[model samples]
Each structure stands twice: as C-alpha cells, then as structure tokens.
Target: MAQPYRPDDRSECVLAFEALEGALRCLKDDIARTERRCQEVRRAYRQLIEVAASDAELPRVEPDSRLYRLTH
Candidate 1:
C-alpha cells in the first residue's frame, strides 16, 4: 500500500528526509560494530579450541560438594 507524492509542504518534507537519513546512518554504524564483534567471537572460539587441543593453561574449575558449599 503506497501513497501519491504531494510535495506542497517542502520544509516539512526536507526535515523528515534528514531525520530518516540520520537514522539510516546510525543503523549502518551499529551494524558494522556488530559485524566486528561477531568476527571477534569467531576468532576467540578458534583460539579456545586450539588451546584445548594443545597443552595450555586451562582455567581450574573446581566442583564443590554440598559440605563445601555450606562452609563457603
């Protein structure tokens, strides 16, 4: 469903156009940042897998017993 172009009101139309263009510019910036973050996550996963396969300083994850939890 589309409407016909009625440009009798020029200033208002210009303002609306500027606002929409600004919004689109901000959207593009946000999208680029998100893409970068996604790539970084992929690289981190690859590094984690490499470390796991080889001998690396793995973080110590100690499982606590019921008594240990009660004390702490």
Candidate 2:
C-alpha cells in the first residue's frame, strides 16, 4: 500500500511560491526583450529595402526573381 501524501510546511510552500513567481517574472522579461529585438530587426529590414529600392545603379529585378516575389 502507498503512504498518504504529506504537504510541506507553510514556510516551505511560501518559499516555493515565491521562487516560481520570480521565475515567471524573468520569463516575462525575456519574452518582452525578444519582442523588442524582433521589432528592431523588422524596422532595419524595411529601411534596407527602402534604400535598395531607391538605389539607381542596382540591376532591375525581374518579375520572376525571388527578390521581386518577396517584395511584391
């Protein structure tokens, strides 16, 4: 037969809860940082595309080209 489950002391339970809350807070911060970095990357990519489009010396893109497909 299995023994009945025993709960931890109140102090131990409180400590565990606090540790979990701290971990959750750290994870939320990491997610926020990643989202910010992604936005920065997207902004940079758009700026690069604008610069490329305005450059006169660059070869014209064909309709079938992958770059044309992506931009279109």
Candidate 3:
C-alpha cells in the first residue's frame, strides 16, 4: 500500500535535493584535489628522469626486468 501524496512530501523532496547537492559538492572537491596531486606526481617523475639520465653510473635496467615492466 502507498501513502497518498501530501504537502509534507514536497518538503521531503526538497530535503533530498539539498542532501544530493551537498554530496555533489564534496565529490567535485575530491576530484580537484586528485587532479592537483596527479600534476605534482608528473612533475616529480620528470625531474627524476632528468636526474637519472645525467647519472650514467646508475645500473641500467634490463628490458625484461620487473622494474622496467612496472615503469613502462
């Protein structure tokens, strides 16, 4: 059995919408933070690559090695 539509239903609907809007705002903030962190990681990776390239003493990773596979 379903309850008949009433004036209180409108208020309940409004409250649900407000809650969803708050959740959406939080999600947007999380995405922005993740994007910034990804940019930072990319910058660090580039710097590391540059440093490694300048240092010939570092042992070269074999193409078949696990480290090479994980990185590439």
For each of the candidates, the C-alpha root-mean-square deviation to the true structure, in angstroms, is: 11.0, 6.7, 6.0
Tens digit of per-residue lDDT, candidate 3, span 3-72: 3345568987776777778889999999999999977876776667668878999776677976454345
Q: Mind giving the per-residue lDDT tens digits that candidate 2 earns over 1-72?
A: 322333567776676677778889999999999999977876775676778779988676677876554454
The reply for model 2, stretches above 4 Å from the true place, is 1-6, 56-72
The numbered model that scores best in TM-score is 3
Better of 1 and 3 by lDDT: 3
Instruction: Give the local distance difference test score of model 1.
Output: 0.65
Local distance difference test values of all predictions, in order: 0.65, 0.72, 0.72
TM-score of every prediction relative to native: 0.64, 0.67, 0.69
TM-score of 2: 0.67
TM-score of predicted model 1?
0.64
Instruction: Estimate, for each residue in 1-67, the C-alpha lDDT of model 1 and write its tens digit.
Output: 2234457888767877787788899999999999999778767765665566576566432346442
Worst 10 residues of 1 by lDDT: 63-72
Error of 2 at 18 (Å): 0.1
